[model samples]
Target: MEYKTILVEKRDGIATITLNRPEKLNAVNVDMRLEFLNALDELEIDDNVRVVIVTGAGRAFCAGADISTFESDPARIRRNLVNLKREPRRILSFEKPIIGAVNGVAAGEGSQWLLQFDLMVASEKATIAWPATSLGMACPYGMIRLASEVGRFRAKEALMTSKFLTAEEAYQWGLVSKVVPHEKLMDAAIELADQIKRMPPISIRTIKEAVNRGLEGYEYTYQAAVNQQLSDDFKEGVQA
Candidate 1:
């Protein structure tokens, strides 16, 4: 399959998906989201892909949804929101271990997507935030995942303030497992992926399933409405 906004590369049992919209800071526009969902679907079936890693090509991991493509089409926005909910749920259901190698800033919905991953590693210079409240938007996934990963109070503060969490701060809050130098971010992620690849593939898949089952209990259902606001242009923008 051809992908315009993302790159998928596989080697040594690991499939890496890089958000390729560097000029847009790899933001999750409608097209990118569709392509991402397709790539995830493909990776889930490819037996050679024992593990998956998600990151971005440019300085920022993902700046969030493409505001430029989001305007005033309520029906399209609803469809986009539905896709947002469905795609991440599919990602979380994948049996293979998935990791997010956050190369830079991850904000709004971008930060929410990281919550679906089994593990996360960030560059020392990376920053994370959920600016939905400031943007007059509600972050359904963020509200749930942040509270579960950090704490309810912290999540509330983060969301309400639209604050940025530095790499070190994120580590302290348990958002990322490791923080490496920016230059070594991919190397560190690959090393971690290699380690997982060395483990028994079946056992890794089982562990992932068990962990996801346990985490599923913490997910809040109220955030489902965030998807209701995604634009139609964004939804149709997905590349196949």
Candidate 2:
């Protein structure tokens, strides 16, 4: 599918999706959400693409949801929220391993988005934060796997404090596999993808499936978080 909010490129058994709304720091809006789902659909069935890399253009990986889009009709808001909620499951269950080349700030829902990836490669300037509590929403997707990645105490502290972790700090906490210079973020991601592609496809897919098996049970929690989008507090927070 042709995309406006993202650029899709395929080469050497790998596909890359670059979030293109750099002017807004690649903050996701409705169009980006729909286009991303469509792009995934296209890539999923392509036999030549063994791995995928997700990154953002310009200064930020993804600053999170475009709040301006949040002040919409109630029903539309619920529908959009529901659509967004399905993304985590779709990504987690994908057959090909995904690497997040986090180039810059990845905050709020952006932080949650990275958690769905099989691996994360951060740039030296990258920063990650989960600010959902301050925004009056529970990040069920993020909450589920964060403790598994970084331990319960650290995850709780990060979530509650809503502070950005530097790339080195994130690496130290085991949130990202490695941190490279800003200019080499995609190169590092592509190198990892190359290594993954060299492995037996079945073995890689099986390993990913086994790792994500426990995450499937969080669907109910995700549903509950989506429902929170309809609450007055959430609306008030958005409007503020």
Candidate 3:
């Protein structure tokens, strides 16, 4: 399938998915979300591609959701919400390590995407922000991932205060695995991918599965989705 908002490139054992909408700092809209997932789906099935790198095309990695694309049509909104209920975490359901090559600012949903990645390599200049509360919105996914990564106290503070984390801060918080110069972000991510590629594939997959199994609590994010879906703040956020 042709993708309008993302680029999928395969080479050696690496498949790179580049978010292509730099105009809006790779803010995910309907088309981008669909195409991004489609790209990951293809990579997942390809045995030759043992590792995947997700990055943005331009300066910023991802600025978050495209608020302008929030559906004003009630039917469309309801349909979307219903779909979310079914597939709340349907981004990249792949076994291979998906490395986040964070090149720049990753905010809101961008930060959420960062959390979902198996490993994150952030550029020194990259900034991570979960300012959803400040925007009259809330990121249930980010908060849940935060509690899973860090402790509950830090998650509560970060979410409630709309704390914007620099690359160093993200590393300190154990959000990203590595931090490198802006020019070396992709290089670092690729290096990590290659390093992991040498391990026995089956063993790697098993290890990943075990780690994910321990985080079964993420399933509770579905409840958070429902809570946010029915919230007045979410409505105001979409409208704003």
Please write out the lDDT profile of model 1 over residues 128-239, one tens digit for every residue: 9998666555576667767888999998989989899999999999989999999999899999999998899889888877766644533354344544345333244332
- Residue pairs with backbone overlap in model 1: 30-234, 31-237, 31-238, 77-230, 81-227, 140-223
Per-prediction CA RMSD (Å): 4.7, 1.5, 2.1
Q: Report lDDT (CA) for all predictions.
A: 0.82, 0.88, 0.80
Q: Kindly provide the TM-score of model 1 when superposed on the true structure, using C-alpha atoms.
A: 0.89
TM per candidate comes to 0.89, 0.94, 0.90
Residue pairs in steric clash, candidate 3?
none
Pick out the ten consecutive residues of candidate 1 with the lowest summed lDDT: 231-240
Candidate 3 TM-score versus the reference: 0.90
Q: Candidate 3 local accuracy as lDDT?
A: 0.80
lDDT of 3 by residue, 1-240 (tens): 679999888888998889999999999888887777677778778889998898998889999888887765556766765544333255434678788999999987778887778899999999988887875656756767778888999998898898888999999999899899899888899899999988998988887666655445555665665566566777886677
Q: Which pairs clash inside model 2?
A: none
Off by over 4 Å in 3: 73-75, 82-88, 214-220, 227-230, 238-240
lDDT of 1 at 187: 93
> Residue 74 CA error for candidate 1 (Å)?
2.0
Candidate 2 runs further than 4 Å off: none
Backbone clashes, candidate 2: 0
Better of 2 and 3 by TM-score: 2
